[model samples]
Target: MVLSYMEGFLLGLGAAVPLGPINILIMNESVKRYKNGVIIGLGAMSSDITYLFLIMFGLMIYVNQPEILNGLSLFGGVFLIYLAYTIYKNRDTKIDIPIQQVAKKSSMKLYLKGYILTSVNPYTVGFWFSVSGYIAGKELNPFITLFGMLSAILLWITLMPYLVHRSRHKISQRVSHWISLVSSIILFGFGIMMFINLFYN
Candidate 1:
């Protein structure tokens, strides 16, 4: 059991460290408003927990169906495209607004954006399904495994924003603009790739 818990923790940490749309968005937000980035992480973590529950309870059998998975992928692709467009549109907007006011006004929006962005990806569901299967095969306690994973995810989200916030002074406006542009391009590419995969595979 102890070994299993440790494995779960390592697996969770590895999974959460990947470069994805959510991570990019969190980093971008953190460079501006640290609190908003943390909120976004919370939202993403919530979605991860939901996927964990679904996989543990064997609901992933339904989620793995090709038709349902394809539909989800389609939605995710479209949403990513929309997000890329939004980011590009706002790329030039100065982040001169007061942090307090921005947080108060956009907290829910940021949270929802994170949740929706993470949840819509069929790949996320598939990854959790595989991870859950591995845990089951190892005879690990589901609760322990989930707890370990959640802890890793929470730690990552919290630490990432804190680090970015601390380094905000070092990041120049031109650098920030480049980051936003690069992030938008990456998201758009991912969205296009999803569509291509859907059609070809």
Candidate 2:
């Protein structure tokens, strides 16, 4: 069981380590409003935990239903396309908004925004679901595996802000713009793959 938990944790870590839209949003938020940023980060982490729990309990079986999987893929692909545009539009943007202004918004609202943003990412949810199903044969306790995965996700969220904070100086506006552009491209690629997968596989 211990080995199983470790394996699950490592797998989850590998999946979550990739820098995506959520990470970029966290970085931007941290620079502009540290407290709200942390809350948002925590909310995103909470979504991960929810995904992990669903996955551990055999939720991936939904993907085997062709109709459902196709619908999810279509929805996910469209959302990715929209997200790509949003990122592209913000390529030249920086964190200039005051914390006081941000603070006027309720914390719950910020939390919900983060939660919904991460939760709506079907590819991310599907990835965890698939991974959980793959490892289900190990006979490990689901809760233990979930705890491990959540631990790793929380650790990543806690550490990532500091890394972003430190590296901000080295990253110029041009570099940030390029990074957003590249990420948008990557998202577009993923969207294409998902669209193809919806029909081909």
Which one wins on TM-score? 1
Q: How far off is residue 34 in model 1, in Å?
A: 0.9
Q: lDDT tens digits, residues 38-137, model 1? A: 9999999888888877776778788788898788779889989998888777676555555665534378888988898888887788788788778879
lDDT of 2 at 114: 64
TM-score of 2: 0.72
Residue-by-residue lDDT tens digits, candidate 2, 95-183: 44344564444789668756756776666666776666666777677677766777777777777777776566677777777877886
RMSD of 2: 3.7
Ten contiguous residues minimizing lDDT sum, candidate 2? 95-104
Assess each prediction's global lDDT (C-alpha) against the native.
Answer: 0.83, 0.69
- The positional error of residue 54 in candidate 1, measured at the CA in angstroms, is 1.6
Q: Among these predicted structures, which one has the highest lDDT? A: 1
